[model samples]
Target: MGRRAALFILFAATALAVMAALSRPGVPQDRALAPGPRGTGPIIVAVLGTSLTKRASWPDRFAGGLSECLGREVQVTRVARANANSRWGLAEAERVAASRPDLVLIEFALADADLTDGVWPGESRSNHRAIIEAIRERRPDVRIVLMTTNPVGGLHRLKRAFLGPYYRVYRDLADELGAGLLDAWPRWPGTASIPDGVHPAPEAEAQIVVSPLLTLVAPGFGAVCG
Candidate 1:
């Protein structure tokens, strides 16, 4: 072919290649890219616990963190109360069963201590097991993640000492149930994750708990780590 003709052919091939690249999935286009896997459906995360979960800021922060990580809308429903226990969490789970959430974060370890008084340790375990079983029965496909509470300081330590067995029960339940566990205990000391030594601080909310928790929930959630 002549030089001019060859040049024209080369230009045509380049244009076609560019077009093909743009048309491929996940490739950015001038108009808009197709929705990613995360955008396929809305993720409903139900957080059940005590005052820590009730903290308006915690859920909001978690929502924001999940949104950033998943690159999709994250709806968080906080079914929590101040000074509540595992029984409350179980009730909340039962109520939420109908809603059919995509994920459930059980934050009742700290509250479980309260059950030791009225309920025996074995009975408390049974109650917690019943709750998990009920949730699974209601929504077989829903994912359950156990969230362990942060360690308490000073007087709160006394509560932890009493509640230690209950906390262990929570861990045991998670293991036996084959549920994902997110323990926020270790992140407390070195990092300033907890504000009043209970609820997560604003800074810690995004970095420590929110980001890591979502990452554990689903892969590729680490994209929101920054």
Candidate 2:
């Protein structure tokens, strides 16, 4: 790519992040992580997240999608808890880094987790950055991918509005470090199959979460609709 193209992409990505922060939401905040040299060797994909990553969740589905795209064996390890909070992530930071992942996806949905407390994300942002620093310490070459999640429903549009800013933490981090991102919130393709609206249903996972992740890691690599 030419210098002009690279700078143009950066500007576009930053603009997209600003737009998502200002308007839509799901996909990571920044588009700064333009595709780079892909890993040709076997890969270890680690996910540090909350409920969205647990009990055979997005991490699991993305593993399958990435495998087909890479045309090689891939291992996915999840460090997730059900509350969709970042507390457990802080506790297990070492374990996450020990996994030595070539790629890492991180999200906590902190703002939407406890709307009763309001949309304060100061702690949420710092803790996640600490986790990223920890992982990066061990593997400097690792590609960290920030992914905003599905739109919430129980609270309806309100929950999404509250949660959108929190997702920006990941986007800003990605931009600062020049990492990868999925930006699932605004980009998610379908309806909330769940009654609560916060968690995406299984079917929604395949289309919104899994397929897009596949497309990100490996373009043209089709994801199976689970």
Candidate 3:
């Protein structure tokens, strides 16, 4: 095919892929991650993960944007620690559940893949399951979201050789446990460079993290273009 024809085909394929991704059934529609009537109270959001999440101003931005989009207040509580993994998160699951949030976002695959931590795939999987279970036990109506953050590269990538498997834990568990997933890993490289090989630069955060999440939870809200 000619160059122009090939470019057209690629663009068409890309559009189709995005459509397919968006069409996939996420958390139940009845739950509607957005808040209730105008008189109702704020939508409580709890974000639990590693430093990547702690640093991701996306949640605050998301809450603000979502509140505007849905015409309701969104209160966000972030419980994340640097260098922590799913194992550490499991210990705090009860605290998170006790907060009585309407929505919970979890991201820890990167930290779990740390070679120094040596949390194997199986153990990581179990930890995630336990954490989810603990939360669900208390708040059965909560809408949980699992996030796979930016892709790692350079020496950081080299160290976390099992990072792919670690990320899959979120995807698998999201399906198994009936949760939403913001699969940001595969979309990162195309969006921007992770100068540190782990974290996305400040400029890229809105696109790499916030955009897709906004698309997931609140469709039609103006997304941050990459």
Q: Rate the local accuracy (lDDT) of all candidates.
A: 0.63, 0.67, 0.74
lDDT of 3: 0.74
Question: Where is model 1 more than 4 Å wrong at Cα?
Answer: 1-39, 114-120, 190-202, 220-226
On lDDT, the stronger of 1 and 3 is 3
RMSD of each: 21.9, 11.7, 10.2
Query: Model 3: runs farther than 4 Å from truth?
Result: 1-39, 190-192, 219-226
How close is every model to the real structure, measured as TM-score?
Answer: 0.70, 0.73, 0.77
Candidate 1 per-residue lDDT, tens place, 65-150, comes to 76766667888887878887766767776787877787777776666654233355686688778777888899986777777556
What local lDDT score does residue 101 receive in model 3, on the 0 to 100 scale? Answer: 87
Q: Write the per-residue lDDT of candidate 2 for residues 1-226, one digit (tens) a residue.
A: 9999999999999966674465455334434334556446677888887776774466766777677666667898888877656656767878988888877888776433465643357877777777778888888877777777766654455444456667666677767766667777776654547656666776666566676566565532222222
> Lowest lDDT 10-mer window, candidate 3?
28-37
RMSD of 2: 11.7
Candidate 1: residue 32 lDDT (0-100): 12
State which candidate has the highest TM-score: 3
The global Cα lDDT (0 to 1) of model 1 is 0.63
Model 2 off-target regions past 4 Å?
1-41, 110-113, 116-119, 156-161, 189-191, 219-226
Clashing pairs in 2: 25-186, 26-183, 26-184, 26-185, 26-186, 27-183, 27-184, 27-185, 28-183, 153-197
Worst 10 residues of 2 by lDDT: 217-226
